[model samples]
Target: MQRANEALQTQVTELTHGKTDHQGSDRHTTTTVVNFQPFSQEIAEEEIPEHVKTLALDSYSGSSDPKEHLVYFNTRMVIAGVNDAVKCKLLPSTFRKSAMTWFTTLPPGSNADFTEFSTRFLSHFSTSRSVQATITAFLTVIQRENESIKSYMTRFNELSVYLEDSVPSVCVAAFKNGLREGRLNGNLKRHQETSMVEIRARARSYILEEEDNRQKQKRDGTTSLKGATHLGPASKFNQAKTNRPGPYQARLSTRPSAPKPLKVVNAAEASKETGTAGMNATCGGTMLNAPVSDILKEATCL
Candidate 1:
């Protein structure tokens, strides 16, 4: 029994070390491949993430065959921490019965493997390579008049992916050249070509700076408009008037009120004259002297 056990252990070790089937031309070598970190991210839960559904749905293009967009949608799955098993299982639930019937018709034994399924899917639908188209798009990327840096960068990155053999420096230069003429673009032009990392850092800085400027402008505009409604040409006219005083008002405000002359009074003389003459006639005949203000008031009244 011990000798039999020893023989079994020897056979096991030989098999583990890949025993040669024959010598020379007929010698066979078995390859043992190690699968290290198969999953991109740790997927602790059994159920797939809900974002996977959204991603698949969003990426699934109706115009193209299912095979044409599988790669595109698969990228999102990889990023979402899904393994091949989970991806295979969860992907079908996203499709309708009519659409899924195509997958049902796949060759026998092909349904078990993800790689096989992908190959079959792509083979069923002809997807021509887009290297030339991608190149054209990359070369023609340009920043629009008021396009955001993020949007421009996103477009640039997407296009750059097509230039598979392009150097990082060349890609960065292409991106810089596509930017609109402004502070950020000028900085990129004057900047020394270092690396894609540094270029992206500068781009991020410019984006933040632009965002701050936009927010400030929005706040200022809101504050000014909050004071009154924007009345087109009339608003401009009102604003100009409010900003500067009217010519007539300014002229009148500077000039002082005109003074009126006081009436000449002779009370003592009138009294002496009245003492000799008949008192009633003298007093009644003389006119009473009035103050300038009172005279002006009387004139105004008249």
Candidate 2:
């Protein structure tokens, strides 16, 4: 009976691979009609919102290998709709007992926290993200150049919790160092007293403050430029002609002159660096200045 079952499984595997090959050929034949996308495996715990990531991972749970699922999950989180912030509302009722209980316990309408979810999911389903590995990754985390301050803070807050044995000060230092330096860093650095709470608060406000200041500066500049007189296209010309001179001095001043031409002297002289004088009148599109001829002659002799 065992041998028969083994044989049946082998036959089934061969049929599956064969079917996949047939489907691949059909897809190639109808490229215009078919749009295919591969399933993802592992996800970056930091990247996607808590809810959507859960769904992606859950969908792949039935695959043959958890390791492949983990990799595909990572690819999905890093890519997918993470930047768009398209979050899903996960159904706790649909989840297995362990995850379902964790979800049900959260405050009403609250999404599962990414840290909590990752811990529960990885511990129960997959060993790809071991505790030590997660902690190490968290410790070495740095803010990506394209990542927003809010996203960076969110990820930092989630990861820092795993460092239960480490002091807050150490984690705070790591978080501070991880943030890309800007007005946010400057404001936080100004306050002598340090804490994650203080940093988080300031960071939240910093982006808004920077944006407002930028808008104000832009408005002021536009107004000033509009009010100012333009004698001609170039502002320097207006300044040079006026400069406390009489009002009529600007009128009397000639229009600003065009830039002086650069003297090439000779085309041959210019083309010397290029080895071939470019399409000369005498050369008739042939190479001038004996270009490559010496090398060719040397090769011929050899």
Candidate 3:
């Protein structure tokens, strides 16, 4: 038994190496024969061998075809190794025909159909290469039926619910928010630049006006000192005329000996007389003498 097992192991290794070599050669060839297989067939659950059935039931409960589901599950296992989260939830008994029913009803280019398909099957699978290979196989079948690539892509988009439902929602929200913020920032930047430009233009205009006024004043000989000197000349001419007495004023000054200079009653004398008249008129008594400043200071203090 041990020798037979060893022989089987060696044969398996050799077969694996041969398959790899064939695949490499096929990659370089222009035309290579490829196999086409359909995934629609159902395997009888009762006919499944006990050990394999136990394993399949544990992992492929939601799939319609246990055999095909096993292939997809194994491929995912190989691709994701032990790090995949969704793999832990798979069970053989999870298989339900309704899970894949949406695929049959989907029109050629409907996103809803593809979305349903992806949600039912593709999302459960972990291996990108396997998923791609499966998609390519489906595309080959579709092309064989003379469908356009556009129709295929439309179906593909419809089926790829993972990208459409989750990734784009999160990514597009963040992207749109970032774009909105950037636009607002750009608008603020433009407004600031415009305000600065207006301020600089206004400042330039004010400086130019000031410079023009200075230049005109200089050209007209009306600069500060020149204007002051011109005003002084007019004042000097008026002073000379005022210093000479008028012809009629000389005759009137000689008469009446100037009447003792008429003891001019200034603002202080007038204020004192008015205050005394008010006190006499109000109290009917002549209030005794007090200096106007003293009276004003006493009244203010009171």
Candidate 4:
């Protein structure tokens, strides 16, 4: 009887152990269920149109400007005529690396709509947003010394692209202020209310005139240099000839001439003789309108 009771107790214990094992397995299954997602039920359920399969988007890895990526995404979506629901679905496909990791970490059902999703994305990546340029930035761009007006214009125009709301008059003002002081600046100052179109036209004319003047000066300088170079050889030859000794120089060099003997004569007698000789020559018609002192001066000069 005791053995039967022991057997019955063992059977009861086995059945109890099996029930506990089954319950433990059921609990484990319940805990394994996952529910993490950033999108709402509506967005998740939204059907992606057939046209979306043909489209491809470049992925963002959180390294570049997030705002630019959004702008590009929005532009394409607008062109494709996709709705907000479709935008939400398509946007995630463009994310990779850190961007995808960021998306995955967002709380479930946090994004109710495309607008909210975009807003959150922008807010989270605010540091990665491209700084919107202002008119102040344009004003600060001064034309460097010796910088060409054409080059300055190109730089100014390139900067203007960032300032979408920049007025033509304001641009003209900024451009005028930034110019190196010269005829262009002076001309711009005279026209207080000039349009950018007129400013550009005036600049073009000035650029042409400046180029022409530069070319003329260059040509003049080249001609002057050539003239100097052409005359250089002749001048050098003349100088060398002047300094060079004659072929008979060695033969001509001989003993110095003896000093003349000193002669003493009366100044009055000499003057009297010179005056008489000059009067005779003047009267003979050989010397015309000649005075004694003039004749003396001419003899002295000779």
Residue by residue across 1-302, what tens digits does model 2's lDDT show? 99999999999999999999999998886863343211112221224456564554444322133345445655665564553122222222234544444444444323334344434444444433334454567667787764556667778876665443334566667787787777677776787535666667667786565445545534443212221222123345444653566757766785687898655334466466567645363343323344476436544555
Native-to-model Cα distance after best TM-score fit, residue 187 in candidate 4, in Å: 1.1
lDDT of 4 by residue, 140-191 (tens): 8898866667768878876554332335666777788898888888887887
The sequence of per-residue lDDT tens digits that candidate 3 reaches over residues 192-273 is 3323223233334434554565556545444353112222233445557657778889888866653443444444455576
- Best model per lDDT: 4
- lDDT of each prediction vs. the true structure? 0.58, 0.52, 0.40, 0.70
Using all chains and alpha carbons, the TM-scores for the candidates as numbered come to: 0.39, 0.28, 0.18, 0.35
Kindly report which residue stretches of model 4 are placed more than 4 angstroms away from their true locations once superposed: 1-132, 164-166, 217-302
- For all predictions, the C-alpha RMSD in Å is 15.9, 32.7, 29.5, 18.4
The pairs that clash in candidate 1 are none
Q: Residue-wise lDDT of candidate 1 within 30-68, one digit each (tens)?
A: 221122222223221345657665653543322355554
TM-score (C-alpha) between model 2 and the true structure: 0.28
Q: How close is candidate 1 to the true structure, as a TM-score?
A: 0.39
Tell me how candidate 2 scores on lDDT.
0.52
